[model samples]
Target chain A: MTPALAVRGATKRFGAVLALDGVDLAVFPGEVLALLGDNGAGKSTLIKCISGVHRLDSGSIEMGGVAVTMGSPAAARALGIETVYQDLALFDNLDPVANFYAGREIAGPRWLPRGLRLLRRRDMSRATGELLTRLQVGIADPHATVGLMSGGQRQAIAVARAAAFASKVVILDEPTAALGLRESRRVLDLILRLREEGHAVIVISHAMDHVIEIADRAAVLRRGRKVGEMRPTPDNRQAIVSLIVGGDS
Target chain B: MTTGQAERAAPLSPATGTGRTRLAALAQRHGAALVLVLVVLLGSLTFGSSFTGAGNLGAIALDASYLLLVATGMTFVILSGGIDLSVGSVLALSGVLAAYGSRWGTAGAVLLPLAVCGLIGLVNGLLIGRARLAPFVVTLATLLFARGLAFAVTQEGNQVYIIPADLALTRIGQANVLGVGVPVLIALAVFVAAGVVLNRTRFGLRVFAAGNGDGHAAELMGLPVARIRVRVYVLSSLLAGLAGVLIAAQTTSGLPTLGEGRELEAIAAVVIGGTLLTGGAGSLGGTLAGVLLLKVIQNLINQVGTLSSAYQQVVSGTFLVLVVLVQATLARRRRQ
Candidate 1:
């Protein structure tokens, strides 16, 4: 089966910083690919390249065996690749319905003039409610502005939005870093749920237990280079940690 | 900044809290209206018949009409987390253009000012949106540029273009529906339209997102963030132009200095109405009440005979500061 995303010899440089150096990674459909790396290990940079925020200086990215260049974030999204950044990029002031439909709003009837064209609020609200319920993400009111939401609730909503929209792949950047214990599990479950739904999920995390519990495979990076890949198991954690710490070097 | 994980979130109910959050939301939305209602009641009680009389109230509404237009536009700009210092100058330029264009009849009078003002707005939008210049700096430069152009056209404020009384432009200004003036009616219509556009449109959603969320995120979501920013500035400039034209027709002559310091007034109205200067959250309802509060205070003070009108500014400034304090507190709470 074709991989959902394939990165071969991905290299990126920012001045003296070798952010991603010849990193090779692949995430297959119906699987969770855990990217394990310490700080400054280029996990973020690699994901950035895949999500079209950073251009690779050398190497190519393939989606289902087709070489593609993601010139912008929109380009990647057009290819059904969505990145949920650390901030979650939610407009806190807008309600859940508004936030969910901010960029992808439904328009009014065709007869309306340009000045009169409006968003279909009822439709957006109903759809958002359904998406959240389907994902089992609980939130107060669809009409409640996100600013009023707790951090965990906000995280759940963000994840729910990604899962609902992403047809091919979803990249989550430190989604659980700021979450509490219970919130982390919620995100972990949501990630596993995504994989179960047959969408490729690439999760960047330092939480080893989470990777062990959910991810089908794990890739470790150190100093911008991919060091090792392993089936995440109870017995292989030490080996994964050693690779992340550059024990081989 | 919160670590809202499932393990921790399950006990805490995942949906945002409804009790206190609902209360805070209500306060943020209604605080301005409450203050406005209180001031009106106080004014009515203290000033008695004069304050409540049709003539005085009409004057207040008419006076607020043009300011309402400008403030409505400012609300959108501020809601998008940007400011246009050039609006006042654009108003002045449009007034002069309206007066000058009156020679060609009503269409010239209306379209000329709009065309010029729209172009000015388009330029501001391009600079701030496309060029990625600071909104403050770009609008500040345009403010000077617009003011200078107005001065040049009016010959250093010596030349005043008097509107022809028989023209349709002047007639529209002088016309009244029932007891209320046309300008007053137009302002009401504009505010209603603004409310609908802000709350019920995709454009409004984009504006809130651009202001409340990260610009990069908006772009990543495929929103034409730059285009949206540009469009708001254009909208603001067009509204300011309309206000200018209305003011000129009402005054029956162009006054180059007419709109001086008006930008601050509109901004104050928007802020007092409960819209954040940082952008993302605001409503037209708050803006309307804010304008009314200021105008009512002005009317009440003038009725006092002994009190100086400068107290109006002092009160408005105080209200603005209070609103800012509330906003800061709310922001801090949200952060925590």
Candidate 2:
């Protein structure tokens, strides 16, 4: 099967530092690809390049086998690529409905300029409610702003937001870094659900057990290059660790 | 599908202390309106016909008209997480420019001041939005610059240009419909239009998004954060300019020093309306109530007849402090 998203020789440079050096990666639909690495291993840089936060110095990205150029996050989103950063990037002052559809609001009169368009609040609220229910992310008050929600709830909302709009790829960066044990488990469960829904989910994580738990495949990076790629299992868990720490080839 | 497991997990309540928290939220949002109503009641009970009389009420609305316009613009600026210290100066400059331009008729009187003030806003926007300068510093500099220009236009405050009483500009400024002042009507119209834009439109949502403490998040979410900032600053200046124009017409002359300290009054009104000084949450309705509340208090002090006018500021200052303290406490409660 054709990969849902593919990167070719993704090279990125920040001044003299080569953040991503000739790295290639791909993930097919219905698969969880875990990006593993230590600090400064270029995991973030590679994902940033893919998410359109930063352009690759020399490389190409193909979505569903179609080579695409994304000059901005909006451009990337237009092509069904969504990234939930470690921060979650939620507007604390906004309610779930507004936060769910901040950039891509369901507003009207196509002829009117983007700013002048009136928000279809009822439609947006209905859709948000449906999405929350589908994801099993429950908040008692739909009118409550996201700021008041728990960390786990906020994580679920962010992931659900990506799942709602992302048709091809959903990249999550350290989604459970700030969550507790139970909350982390919930997020992992959410990721598995995304995989079941046939999305190409790329997760960046430091937790080795989490990778072994939900990841269908693991690609390890070390010092700006792909060190190894394999199916992570209990048998080869130590081997994956070795690859991440550059202990052995 | 994780269906059974998902169903087993209970829905989390929005807050731990639901009843008390919700009440606090409601009060924080609508407290200004409640206080305004109470003030009017107290005044009526104490002063009788003098306070409840339609003539007195009309005068209060008329007095509130200019501050309402300035505060309305301040609402947008504060909502977008920035402050424009130059608004007071811009108001004074616009008034002087309007009077000076009145020689060329009403069109010149109206357009010239707006053009200059809008340009001032544009400069402020570019500096704050694009250059990423500190808003406080940028606008503080502009406050001095605009104030200087205002005095220069009137030859160092020596010459006050007076609009002819018979001129259309002056007549329009002083005009009243059904015993309501023209400035009051215009202020109301501006507020209504602004309310729709801030509450109902996509731009309004983006403004809220832009004002988030973490603006970088808004940008990542694909909002035009810089552009929103620029538009809000320009919107603020234009409204202040419009207020200046109307005031010039009413008084029939532009005094370079007319709007001294008005920016503080506008800020006070906005904060008293329950807009967070840190930004990202506020309402025009609350600001309308805030302006009215301040004016009503002033009128009430006047009704007392014995209290010095200086007491008006003292009361307003004390009220502002009280409201802010309440807001801060409520915000902490919500976060918890």
Candidate 3:
């Protein structure tokens, strides 16, 4: 099958620094592609280009075999691309339902401008409740704001939000970085669920164990280029590490 | 790991502890309303017929009507994690414009000020929102510009443009229904509409999201953060202009210096009403209570007869400080 997202010869530069240089990557639907790199290895730049945070200097991105150009994050979202940044992009003051549907609110009448329309609070709350239940993302009080939530719960909420609208791709930037052991496991399970639901998942992570645990294919970037790609297993785990660190396998 | 994988969702129980916390949150949220009630009761007991009198109460509401308009606009700005220092100046400018425009009839009187003030707000929005400039600095410049423009129109505060006494606009301001000033009734209508817009609309959600202390996050959520910012500033200036029009009608003249320092007063009222100065959470109801509380205290100070009028400022200042302290404490508790 054609990959859900394909990047060809992606090159990005910030001033004089070459962040992503002629990198080619693809991940099919229902697969988790862990993008691994050390500091300044260009993993972030590559994903930023795909997620529409930054434009590629000289490259093209195709979604489901159609070349598409996204000018902003909003444009990317319109094409079913969602990014859950390291910060989770959560409004601490808003409860889970409000947080889940911040911009894409379910409102009515279809005649008024998008801003003036009344919110369909019941519909949104019911949908949020169902989504959270399906993901097993437990918040003790659904009415309470995320400000009082634990790190794991917040991470799950963020992932669940992406899962709700991301029909084509879900890109997670270090989702488990701030989570604890149990929390990290929950987030990993959530990512696996995304894969099971047929999303193209691109995860940027530093944790080798997490990459090995949930990643279907590991793509390593070193010094602005794709160094290697492999199906991460216990047998070749060290070999993947060697690719990332520029050591001989 | 296998056992933990099947984690059960906790039943949402309103435990006694949670109930107590909820009650506390309620108190904190309605703190302004509570204080206003207490003050009203104390005033009624202390001053008897004068404080409890409908005429005095109506006068107090009339005084609050102008500030209420200003603070209503300020609520949107603060809720969106922004500030508009130009509101007072914008108010003055709109008033002068309204009075001068009265020469052309009611349409000219109302629409002219609104159009000009709305354009000024649009400029402020474009500068602060589109240019990504700091709101504080950008609105500060507009504050000076608007104040200067108001004076320029009035010929350096020398000319006081008067609305015709028989004009429809002036009649609306001067006329009362059931012992209430028309300005007070107009302010009440504005508040009701504002409350609905803030609570139940998509724009309201976006405002809160934009104020989430991280505009980037809101932007990533597919929100037009810049547009939201720009619209709020426009709304604020438009409201300020509306207030100026009412004042111009009430007094039958526009004084370029009428609204000096009113921006600070509006800010104080908003903060006292429990809207976080840093943004993200607040209500127009709280702001209403805040405005009323301030005006009521001023009226009470007048009723003292022996006390100096300056004492009004002292009480307002102290109350402002106390309210802020309470809010800060509650916010810290929430964080913890």
Alpha carbon lDDT of each predicted model:
0.83, 0.88, 0.87
Tens digit of per-residue lDDT, candidate 2, span A1-249: 899999999999999999998999999999999999999999998988888889998989999899999788888888998999988889888888888887777888889887678888888988988988888888766767778788998998899989999998999999989999999998998999999999999999999899999999999999999989989999999999999998754
DockQ of every candidate: 0.40, 0.47, 0.53
Which is better, 1 or 2, measured by lDDT? 2
Q: How far is candidate 3 from the true structure (C-alpha RMSD, Å)?
A: 5.2
Give RMSD to native, each candidate: 5.1, 5.2, 5.2
Over A142-185, each residue of candidate 1 has an lDDT whose tens digit, in order, gives: 55567677788888888887887789999998889898999988
Candidate number 2, chain A TM-score: 0.96
Strongest candidate by DockQ: 3
Q: Lowest lDDT 10-mer window, candidate 1 chain B?
A: B4-13
Ranking by TM-score: 3, 2, 1
lDDT of 3 at B58: 84
Worst 10 residues of 2 chain A by lDDT: A139-148
Quick one: best lDDT, which candidate?
2
lDDT of 3 by residue, B6-50 (tens): 010100111111655555556556788899999999999989999
lDDT rank, highest first? Answer: 2, 3, 1
